[model samples]
Target chain A: MIHFLLKGVLHDRHRSLLPLIVITLGVALTVLGHAWVNGVLGESFVMSAHFSTGHLKAMTRAYAEEQDQMPIDLALIGVKEIMDELAGIGEVDWAPRIRFGGLIDFPDESGSTRSQGPATGFAVDLLTPGSKEIDRFNLTSSILSGHIPTREEEALITYDFAEKFHIQPGDRFTFFGSTMEGSMAFGNFIVAGTVRFGAEALDHGAILIDLTAGQRMLGMPDAAGEILGFFNNNRYDQKEAQAIADSFNARRSGSTDEFAPLMVTMRDQEGMAQLFDYTHIISAILITAFVLAMSVVLWNTGLIGGLRRYGEFGVRLALGEEKSHIYRTLIYEALLIGLIGSVIGTVVGLALALYLQVVGLDMGDAMRASTMMMPSVIRTQVTATDFWIGFIPGLFSMTLGNALSGLGIYKRSTAHLFKELEA
Target chain B: MENKQIIDINNLVKRFPIGDGYFTALQGITLRFVAGEFAGLVGPSGSGKTTLLNLIGSLDSPSEGSVVVLGHEVSRLSHRESAALRNYHIGFIFQTYNLLPVFSVYDNVEFPLLLQKRDAVGRRKAVMEALDWVGLSHKAQSRPAQLSGGECQRVSIARAMVKRPELVLADEPSANLDAKNSHHIIQTMKRLNRELGTTFLFATHDEKVMGYLDRIISLDDGRVARDERPLCVNEAQSDSTAEENGHARRQARI
Candidate 1:
């Protein structure tokens, strides 16, 4: 029976070609959409975790609440003790940063503020031979002009700010701000190198200084605004990260009398979990809509096939073929077409997916205008689920369409067969 | 052995709806056929020969009477029961040679045996024999559209006879054929009837078809106007013994 139906489909290109093309294109589009969504959203999430926040971070209770305000007064003190304890943990790397804001003075040989502007400052560990923080954010490639800073008295400033002040690589400047203890704090630093941060917010007004300089300038010894930690592999899972954070806190409770520091995974930091969930919901809605609309198109295709072949059905009935047999044969033909179409579409879609994965679509222009610190190229990622996801809708909707179309055969009266015969 | 009645029609009436009224195609028609007879119902255009044949074939039920084909009370049988009666006990050949256009000649001939659930080996044997009987063994792989009209009709005949049914109903089987093809078709059917003892009934006005029938039942205005035993040129009879022992009884028709 299957061979007979296959021959009929292969023989009648006029009747079967249109439906086969439609099913193939529909499945391909569905698979491409799923792969694109997973790729773009997955890359964006991982980039955000790597650059701005680590898989897990630690902050004092008061500091975590107002960390976004760059409150150096609420910073975690005695970070050395916390860093030592983290060293004993498994497969983790920790980095410390002092995020601050202060005025920078471009003095005119009189030791006075000739031209000054407020700047948001980042104080991170420099390459004291090898700083994990330098590699974590990939700051080396972001240099536009000068060399990286290696001394406590030298720093990297944004090229935009350097250009505004006509500051050269060896020029000196002063930063003055209130310390965490509410006392006057001052610093003198030479411009080491100008950098382009690539990120929109940071490129416009950033000042990077070594962690030792930031601690001295803020008048807080051995204090950091935040401690960021990532796994050795950098494959961050939110649930796993949260488990580590919770277990660390539980162990800290057993020993500490000083309100031991709290750990929070990246998702818990900024209501990011809900945002990630919404992306999945959007992807699901897109796939469901495509399936439903594709099913209706195929249902109409079945109806058209049936109406065109009413004469054939009549002849078969007159020749003593049972009505059920005729209807069932039509459905089996639809199943065979669906299987063939799905295989073709899957192969084509996967080919396109692999091409996109290797040769990504460049979004450099769009990236320049956005604040995300993501790579300029967006690529697709194909998985095992992509190959089979479209098959569910292909087989189910086509068979249902054929079955619905076959019901019309039962409505026809047996008298119609003889009338057709005499015609 | 040839006296067993396979079709019994009594007072059969068939009507068609015509613009809020009825047009009667067959009214008060009575007919009977036995196991191994070659018969044709002869008529003009408006006569009810084809309608009577349809009733006997159980393609449609009667409006007012009873038809019993192969033990089915035709009007009272369920759709499945009626289809089963047609599938196993009756075979049909039509004027248009309604061969399935997608199937090859071999497959077309094998259709009925497939419905009868014959084994693959038996189906192959039966299809080959039927094709050979119609002298179409060389055209087994040809499609209906590729065949000439006569060859298509032969394929149809092979399809009908492959199951070796007890009854064969043909409606205007030679209407579309030239005289040459017409003679070949009726001759093949006659040989099958004589050799296999299968009952044959036809509804046709073609005199070329009537000349080969063992019996002719003429219908006019939905009535049996004449019933006669016709002389078949292909049957060879011993003249003295044929006349002395009532030759019509040994001829082929009831």
Candidate 2:
């Protein structure tokens, strides 16, 4: 019986073709949009976590409040104690970092000032064994020339900054900055390499140095501005991070020290919560709007088709087929159509999404002046959920349309059908 | 089997709603049909023949009185039970040759058996037999759209006869055919009636269809005007002629 019905549907172009096409195109568009949005949100979260916030960050309460200003004066003391305590926890790695601003001076052969510029500097534990700082920053792949810092006085600057200064490896430069105690500090550093972080905000005028060199130059012994904790899997979990933060804060519960260590999750940072909420809302809106639109179109198609087949249904009813049986058969046919169309649409949509995932879209020109820490090239992320997401609207809308249309079967009386037949 | 009563209707009245009032289509109709009888309800358009036929077929319920077909009360049967009765014991042939356009003649004939849940082997055999009876075995693979009007009607007959139901209702079966094709369709139906012992009922005013029926029940203005058996009328005429011959011989002897 199903075989006969399938033949009927396949042979009758007027019955099945238009609805199939609509379902296929609608499902494909829905799948592609979902994956694209997911990719954008996932990438944005990863980029923010990588550059500005780790999975978790710990700093002094006073410094955290004014952390955006790079308050070296309120930097945390007894960093060795915090590092030791953080290291005892499993499934997490702790690293200390210092963010600072300084002035650079280039000298001529006659020992006179040639040129100078202001730059932002980041210092990490470069000389420590088994340190993940270089890999975490992805500096190995970002290096345009020369090598990473190998000594306390060695440093690496952004390739763009290097080109602007016409500086080469092994060139000595003077750095002038303030220490934690408000005294003027100075140091001479060798340019060991050049690197670019790909993000415009980080690659414009950036400098990198060893933690020991940074501590000595800033005159901040046994102190650090912030300590970052990264999960072993390199994926951020908001709940877990919050729990860890709560546990760490509870240890210092009621203390009056303004310089006490405070921990915060990545999502607790400025503007991040709104971004995630917007992403969720956008995904919901996009899928819902597409589904409703598809349903309306398919529903009209079903109603028109039913109207055109009034004679056919009349014949079947007169031939001893019950109205309920005919209605059920129509539903089965629509589901079959939905299944076929959804399969084809999923394949087409997935192919397009996979292409985007493989060969990402470059936004280098757009992001050149932007300060946001986002990658120059954006790629979509495909998850397991994308595989079956299209089936929801495809099957649901087609079945719903046909079910509404099939009600006409019961509305028609057999006597009227006979009159219709005679006519 | 010939005397077994298959349909019994008493004071059956059917009405249609028109503009907040009733348009009576059939009124005060009392009739009965026995098995193996080739009968027809003959009337002009709007004379309630089709309405009476629908009531007997259990397609509609009576507005006034009772209708019983195959021992099941037509007016009392639920939709499902009514459909079941038709599916198992009744077949219908239509003026328009309402064959499923998408299906071949073979499939159209096989459909009723499919509804009967007959196995595939039985369905194929019965379909071929019905097609052969209608002389459409060669056209079994042809679709209804590909066939002529007569051929399509032949397929319709095959479809109706495939399940070998106890009763067949044909409504104006020859109305859409030409003179020659009309005779051909009626002749095929007459042959099936003689061979299968299945009762056949028709709602039509077509003279060609009436000529082939053993019994003709004429209806007018939603009421039965006359009931006549043409063959029985012929037998009665012969008996009167024999009695007249005897009277003339006796008078000559006196």
Candidate 3:
């Protein structure tokens, strides 16, 4: 029965070819869309974990509410001892961030100072720099055009910000802020090399100053606002990480009164997970629509062809062929069609992915600069999983079309068949 | 066995709807035919001969009464059972010589055997013998479109008989052919019928077909008008044996 069905399909090759091509193309697009989403999310997760947040982050409860609402005084009270305790935990790689939010004052070309409209800046401890952890922050091959800040007198600014402020390496700039004692302080720092983090937002808005310099300017001593941890690989397992963080908080409640009120871990600081979910939903919708459209086209073509074969079906029935036999033959034909379509679709999808990956997707320079801190290329990457995703949809469409065509055989009656023969 | 009836119909009726009113295609037909007979069902166009033949062939069910063929009530059988009965015991020849255009003449003849679970060797012997009976063995490799009208009809005949069915129902088997092709097909069918002792039931309007049959059943408006058996060439020469048999049957009845 299968052999006969196959022979029939092959005998009508010209008629079946069009629908097969349409279904294959539909499946290919579906695969490419899913691959694109996976590529984006995977790259984003790596960037966030390695460079920005690590597997988890710990910050003051008030600072966790919102960055702007964070109190500058929260770090000065007993947080240093808590950081030491967390670092003592064998599974943790903790880094302290002495970050300050301030505006950079740009010197105009005429040598007159001008406001740079509240440009954000961060100050880190360069002495204890975690080179392995920090290497992930390198988005491009260029070495940021400057040296890291080594003293209170030296600072590093992002290249985009440096260009905007008319500042150069070795130039001096003034920083002003109130101390923790409620007194004003001012200092001048020589410009170090500018860094290009590749991220448009970070590149245009950030200035990096030495940690102690920022501490003196902000008037807080021996305190940092947050501790970022890179847990051992096992600790970073999503379920185990949440459980460990919760247990740690519970233990702190029994051990110390001051640590009880502190926020242990911040989950919302990791936007990468949310981005993954959002892209996946979009990809699913797009792929479904593509498959549905292809199914409709294939079904329509098959239906028309099957209807034209009604006379042949009628003759078979008159010759004592059962309805089941007719149906089985048609279904066999459909399966063969689907198999061919899936193979072609898989090849086409892989080819498309390779082509795009080579040429790259142009998301424009501004968007690239903005998200450059993330490592995924904007182009699609071809993978084995992508081929499967494309192939299944085509197989489904062909099966559905074949089932619909088989129904036409049941519409005929044996008595009417003899009438057709007489005609 | 000599008195057994191969086909029996009682009060058979077939009605169809036409423009909100009912039309009677066959109204209470009652008839029977015995085995070893070449019978003609003759009528003008729309005279209901084809309708009666369809009922006898088990291709349709009679609306009112019983259609019994070969000791089984056809209308009582399930659809699948009826199809099976047809495949096993009945053969059909159509006026259009309905051969599968895709298949060669040999494959077409081999088709009915496929419905059975016979192995390849048995199938090959049966198909070749049937083709040889129809005098079409030489054209076995040609497709239907490549054959002449008479050859195509011969192929249809071979496909029908390859299974060695008990009954063969032909519907206007020569309607598409010229006089020469029609005569050629009729002669081939008659030769196979005599040699194999198979029952043939033909529904046709052609007068040429009526002359060759041993029995003629004329139908008008779905009713049997006349049943007649004519003498064959051999029977006409053996007058003493026929009369002696008739006298013995009458004497035994008395």
| Model 2 agreement with the true structure over B1-254: per-residue lDDT tens digits | 37999999899888989999999988898989999888899888999987887888788888999999999998888878888888888988998998988889998898888777889999999999999999999998998999999999999998888888889999899899997798789778877887898889999877666656778898999999888775532212333343343354346449
Model 1 lDDT tens row, A1-423: 455567778877745687788778766766776677777776676666755677888877777777678788888889999999887766788888888898898887877777898887888889566677776656787787778887899988987788888888988998878798878878899989888664545666678999889999998799988888888887777777888788878876766443357888887776567766776787678767776776677666766776667677766776677889889888888787777777777777778878887787877667766755555667777878789866755666777777776786787676675565456
Give the Cα-based TM-score of candidate 2 against the true structure.
0.82
lDDT of 2 at A367: 90
Residues B107-225, candidate 3: write the lDDT tens digits: 78887777776688999899999999989899988889899998999999999999988889998897888866777787777777777777889998775665566677878887777
What is the DockQ (computed on Cα atoms) for candidate 3?
0.38
Q: What TM-score against the true fold does each predicted structure earn?
A: 0.75, 0.82, 0.74
**lDDT: the better of candidates 2 and 3:** 2
Q: Using lDDT as the measure, name the better of candidate 1 and candidate 3.
A: 1
Instruction: Pick out the ten consecutive residues of candidate 3 chain A with the lowest summed lDDT.
Output: A257-266
Cα deviation of B229, candidate 2, in Å: 5.4
Q: DockQ scores for all the models shown?
A: 0.38, 0.46, 0.38
- Candidate 1 local lDDT, B1-254, one digit each (tens): 36988888889888988999999988888878888888889889889877787777777788988999877788998777777888888888988998878889998888777777778899899999999999999989988999999989988888888888899989899999997788788878888988998888999988677767778898988888888774533354333332322344334434
The digit string of per-residue lDDT tens for model 3 on A1-423 reads: 445555556656543576677767776776667666655555555556554555656665555545443345555345577676776664766666655555566555576786454555555556454533334445234246667665767877777667777678887776665454556656567787787764554666666666667777777676665666666551345555566567656765655343233434334464545654665687667656766676676666557656656667766776677778877776666667777877887788778877776665645363744644554246676667786776555676566666776685665457775565455
Best by lDDT: 2
lDDT of 1 at A24: 80
Q: Write the per-residue lDDT of candidate 2 for residues A274-334, one digit (tens) a residue.
A: 7768867987887677767766766666667666676787777767778888888888988
Lowest lDDT block of 10, candidate 1 chain A: A251-260
Q: Worst ten-residue run, lDDT, model 1 chain B?
A: B237-246
Best by TM-score: 2
